[model samples]
Target: MSLPPDIADLLAPKYGLDPSICTGPGLVAATRLRMEINGLDDEFSYYDQLRQSGEELDAFVEELLIPESWFFRDRVPFDFLKSWVTESWLPTAKPEVDVLRVLSLPCAAGQEPYSIAITLLEAGLRPEQFSILSGDLSPRFVEQAREGTYRSIAFRGEDYVEREKYFEDIGEGLIRVRSFVRNLVSFKSMNLVCAEDYADDGPFQLIFCRNVLIYFNDDARRMAFEGLERSLTDDGVLFAGHADAIFRINDDFGRYGPPGAFCYSRRAKSETEDVPDALPKPQSKPLPAIEKRRRFFQTSKVAELPKSKDPVRLPSADSLTEAKRLADSGQLEDAERICRERIDTGPASADACFLLGEILLARKEVADADAQFRRTVYLDKSHRDALFRLALLAEQRGDSREAGNWRRRAANRAQPSTSMTNSPST
Candidate 1:
């Protein structure tokens, strides 16, 4: 009993989990299971050909593991961690406290754990004072971490001075992490999803598990969070993806964020005695005329465009177009300022409103962009651009039905107006 040739080829080199381990009727089942676990679709067209080439299989596995990450990714989270540790966690530590353990589970090729090491070093902690446990499921990634060498291109256009201070040029366009930073981190191969993988080496103080849980289903997320809770100390904090929220998942953790990123801390025993209100309540008021107009567009099929009044003194249409051009060129803050000034003078200008929404969307201010799009639609129900953008936002939030509806409405409104010619009366 032999496995499918393609399936065997795909799993052999990349996972080092031999497909030949299964025999007889179990081969197909094992192959399908491997595909599912690796998040590969069952119907890959090139599955047959790809299996024969170890290179192709390795490339596919590489794609699955190489998630988007960078040096000091999401800077706000690091800043918050630094302040929280110095102002809150460190002060609470006893003078004789021998070790402060921080873990970066599934640390990938080590960018995140290394970033944590640099942060601790910058905060005046010596390598001996703290230990970073960096673990990953991939043996290849673990080996790479141990090597601590990276292509200079990985630095991108980052500050050259910081790179010089932290990295030793290892030649051939590779730079090695300084020993001081490298020494703080211990690389190990551990599968986070396994129950009995690593011994109880922690009551870890901080765990950076960013961007890993987004791939998980709800059940897997619950299991991962439970594992994290068990691994953490009473006062431990867990940092997740910037876009991910765990507030609805468990009451055991409290969510906090500065300006850009959100994190969770295990709820303290004292918190049970005095539960703080999590969200602010909005004061009730009657909807303004503009808001009412916006709501009407949202709920009603009738298109009602706002009438222009007295040629309102607004920025030239050129300025609005210029702002968009600037924004597309990556001058975001500048574009936002220009659009905001135009909006201040002529609040009903849908073009300006839409431009502002584009800038806000680029900045990841989804809620703000949603409001601006609503306003743009209110001022000009035929604003197809705003409707399309709003539809995209809906799609991003997983509201496919609403997204389709909005897109249909936008398409209807964007249709070319009919023109008529009549013969003169005889």
Candidate 2:
């Protein structure tokens, strides 16, 4: 059986889980299994117990949101961390301020924050020169993070080299992080959707929130980013997952470097921050159910998103190529319009659908983009780009099985004639 609608509705406000994850069969089976293990009579009983019992709720969230991560899970972020500290942070270090504060929100057991600690040390900073705060929604995860023990699977590639220096072999393929590394970090349980919980923990110089926001629905994302924005210092850099570009809607930050950097710095205060496309219109109609529920949890009203610039008509060209050009130029609405027109006027084209999907993603309309990509694959099963996109979207939403299936399909369809040899591993 699937997660019940009432239980799913409780998730976003209570635990910050995206309701869309409920549509997958994995969560359904997991919830049913949990209920049986708990000896609950029915879904309603499970819901009642969850609401009344904090332990049960935490356990349920843990079971549903099982994390998959490792030391230096993505090497780019850690490499950038070391570079940023060496090039950017050290030059401006204040004589009176000896300690650099960093945070890894939803630190996912302990790897990410520990990775940050190790990177800072590698950058020649002593443990006393920096402090790290890590948090996750799961109490179990927080406790495990505090324990600082991991199986060999937590080390990937050359990561074991660092592990050897910092971790003691505890036998049975387990390793424990040394006291020096563990001393630099403090771990706790937190729900990012509750912005007020960490309101005073602010002004972190560097925040690593990678691969996190993609799991939240729109309102939850806004709430979480609000907290992140408030917590970061004016000159601080925020490193996030490439897929977590939803924060761009607020304009409080600007891309710090190249697109692949996945890093952002707060825009200067003199610049106006605009919210665009994510807000609802005047109440001529009822708001979406998710929007209505979202509004109920907000402590203040959010500004309406700014309207897009008017599309300038251009000379007709090859429709697909023109759309690509427009999208590349950041004229997303115009690109989207061309793609839609092609779909509406001509026979269904997988290329058009795929391009439309890309346009929607650029606009941060994730659900719509997912639908378009699904349509593209339906039209042409061998469309590798669409398959790859579906895999990423599935993984972002915590559907590992679907992600693996889509990735395998994408690999099978890779063309031998293409110059690219092997696909990059995530």
Candidate 3:
């Protein structure tokens, strides 16, 4: 099913989404689901509702938002982040700019920003020596990030022993990022596509916008890159996703450090000369000045979501552990039983729902498994593992749009932290 062209037109320019991406089957189904859930009887009514209600529009966009991320996902960048701070940034930082300021745009559910804090700490910078600002387009993600709690699934790198020291294991397979790391970072809800939202935040020394920008069409991509350039200091470093292909945007930045690092430094006459021949250097003419930024998303485009005062409760840790052990030991029935019992006796448990979903999948109850995964997300929006499973389920059922949505959601929550093998040098 194709999304209404009018709706696509409404969303694409506002959020910087590729118009074509809005036409996916999964997205179409999700759109209809939103319409149904909101009591709209037809697409026309849905479009009208969206036009009239910013909260409804945000909900529709939230369905498409990807928040996939995990801690220290791709290790090379963190290694480079630490090195750049200690070896490069510190030596030349002006006395007036004493504190190292970093920004992580689209920080997902806080994994990337927290990872930055940990890297800075590991680099011997005291918490007071550096500050981090993490932002995402989704308010739900920003709130989740501020909570500083996550499932163990959020950690995927081999440095488990080292990273473990910075987390305290809360019950039910969850961990809370230590206060020392959490204190160094501030979280905010922001739309980077809106230049006004971005203009006030930076001139940052280092910026990590990794794994974003691949979702934009040409116009949005250009605008996004220009915004990043405007926010970066003259000599500051900017890290991008490998697939972002920022080199194609313009010669404004030259590759910094090694290839897979996907980092760029503002192109100055001397700096451009050091860039590899693969990226042709610009002529010696002075770079053009930045234009005044434009603001696309306006005040009327947003409405506050009502806050819930209820506290969340999860299944006991021992119950979750036993369920995992039973499932691993080939006793899926017992595991499923324990999960259901937990759900019945306690407040909704995302952990229990996720585990039951896994068990159902193992039992080949695909439809039931999908429902359980959905339930897990309903309980905890930032459950990366559940989102991943939902994506896999969608893909297996040949619903590419649904799979893409789920994958993007999971991808945003996970940071790509490990070194890329056999990647080309920039």
- Which segments of candidate 2 are over 4 A away from where they belong? 40-54, 268-426
Ranking of all candidate structures by their TM-score, best first? 2, 3, 1
Cα deviation of 169, candidate 1, in Å: 1.4
| Better-scoring candidate (lDDT), 2 or 3 | 3
* Model 3, runs deviating above 4 Å: 25-29, 32-48, 93-97, 268-426
Full-model lDDT for every candidate: 0.62, 0.69, 0.70
Q: How many steric overlaps are in each model, in order?
A: 0, 1, 25
User: What tens-digit string does per-residue lDDT give for candidate 2 at 1-426?
Assistant: 346676677776776666656656557666787899998767778878877877887688788877778998757667767776777566656535546778788877898898889889998787677888889887789999988999888887875245578889989888998888898898887777775655456557678888677668778888888777767654567888744663344654555432244666644333444312111111222223333333543444433333324322322448877777777777777777777656643445788778888877767778778877876776688888888888899888887878888899989985621111222111
Give the lDDT of residue 292 in candidate 2.
Answer: 39
TM-score of each: 0.55, 0.65, 0.63
lDDT of 2 at 351: 80
Model 2: residue 332 alpha-carbon error in angstroms: 27
Off by over 4 Å in 1: 1-62, 156-161, 268-331, 334-426
Weakest ten-residue segment in model 1 by summed lDDT: 417-426
Clashing pairs for predicted structure model 1, backbone only: none
Order of models, best lDDT first: 3, 2, 1
Higher TM-score: candidate 2 or 3? 2
